[model samples]
Target: MSTTTHETRIDVDPDVPLVRITREFDAPPAKVFRAHTDPELVARWLGPRGLEMSIDHYDCRTGGSYRYVHRRGDEEYGFHGSFHEVRPDELIVQTFTFEGEPDGVALEKLVLEDLGDGRTRLTSTSLVDSFAARDAFVASGMEVGVREGYERLDEVLAQG
Candidate 1:
């Protein structure tokens, strides 16, 4: 069995307002894509290890919108977004905004590629409005969250 560690890549360009992440899953593209598009699956592995995620509403189709909250103890962080385009098992484009800083919105795009022998590669790009916003994201310890999230996803895949 192929392991799912040391293959995740998180890249932040020094000159651009963008963040790119690439990771491979030991599962088929369909299953991997479903994990991304499904709210229940997202909650299972989307954030840091200790936070609990609650979905207010999630619709993964084009023109659809979603809102969710992450709670850790008494503190809660809310995020909401609109799905701009969705192509099953292939690509997703969306607008993401954290509620506390409503004006900082990012355009996010994700692409899934099928690799033979039940493996999938997922690449995600987030385009912020400004360099400061992108830098803020990098400074937010996103790498740890992302790496841990992928580890959680590996566990989820192993269960099925």
Candidate 2:
């Protein structure tokens, strides 16, 4: 269960307001899905490694909403999202918003593909309002958070 063995791919569409991220996990879809849907599991591995995450509320179901904060020393970043659709071990569609940028709401879809042999491929696509918004997101050092977060997730999955 080495983090360096897995690769996380991030693609930013030049002509569209979309970002696609794909990653493979050694665990099954059910395990990865639970890590996403379960609030406690999510809190364990959802951001940069050194940030402490706290969930104000997390309801990962259809029509539910969630709010969480990531804190690093004196700084805190808040994020909230609404779950539009949630299908067990298959898909999740949600709206994501960073509290700091209220105007940049993005619709996100997460799909889990079972790759057999207890492996799963997780693909997430985020559609924002405009290309500018997407560009800003890509320029915001998001890759660090995403890569480190998935590495942490790998550790969590290995523990199970």
Candidate 3:
């Protein structure tokens, strides 16, 4: 078994208005792609560590809608998004809105690549309307949450 801590690549534009994060998983591309579209799988591993998720609705096809709520103790965060494009095993594009800050919505593009060595690399790019908004999100400790979330995903994949 290959025991390697996957490094997350996050890029923020100092002049532009976008944030990008790339991560690699030990699982195959098919499995990784399924995790994103499958409601059961996503609800199991798609939040910050210790946050429980409740899926209100999930339709992963093109032009479909997805809504979910994440609960952390007494606080709950809701997110709703619309899928712009959904190409199986390849790419997905969507518009995301956070109920916490409705004005902080973004367009997200996620691409999955099969690395051929029993690994899959997922690259997620999020474009906000302003640089300040992008910066604020990056400063919000989302990186740590992302790391923990992926670690949870690794555990989920390992279960089977």
Candidate 4:
């Protein structure tokens, strides 16, 4: 199904070690990349709509570290990770772990393609250690959160 806002098409292959999600954005690759690196912009669209994000630390360079918390009412979730690779306007690879569910941690890579004409395509692939880890991520409602987060990102991009 198509969405009025940006759409993320996720594909899960049981035999593959990764889950991939691809989406197109009206913004340029550089602008989209900056939205991911800039802590303020990142925080604004990092979690579910009802949740608020607070970045304790964020360093987007290679080998850099990041820690943030997602809060909704009285509940809070913490996530911390380190960047494995960073290629500005091209790709980003990182290890991501949620404190609430460490078993679901995975190595994630985001590849950005500049479609030109003020458009970009982002493909995110997360490689997990086991199928169970992947299953847990799906069961945790992360897909919904990710979609919502991107919708928020669309709004942020449109505002500027």
Deviation in Å, model 4, residue 51 alpha carbon: 0.4
RMSD of each: 1.6, 1.1, 1.6, 2.6
* Cα shift from native, residue 23, model 4 (Å): 0.6
lDDT of each: 0.90, 0.95, 0.88, 0.88
Best by TM-score: 2
Q: Candidate 2 has which clashing residue pairs, if any?
A: none
User: Among all windows of ten consecutive residues in candidate 3, which has the lowest summed lDDT?
Assistant: 1-10
Model 4, span 19-47: residue lDDT tens: 89898988888888999999999998887
TM-scores for all predictions? 0.94, 0.97, 0.94, 0.94
Cα lDDT of model 3 by residue, 18-68, tens digit: 999899988888888888899999998886888899999999999899999
Backbone clash tally (model 1)? 0
What is the C-alpha lDDT profile of model 2 across 1-160, one tens digit per residue? Answer: 4543499999988778999999999999999999999999999999888999999999999999999999999999999999999999999999999999988899999999999999999999999999889989999999999999999999999989
Q: Looking at model 2, how many pairs of residues clash?
A: 0
The better candidate by lDDT, 1 or 3, is: 1
Those runs of model 1 whose alpha carbons end farther than 4 Å from true positions after fitting are 1-3
Pull out the clashing pairs in model 3. none
lDDT tens readout by residue for model 1, 1-56: 44456477988878889999999888998888788889889899887899999999
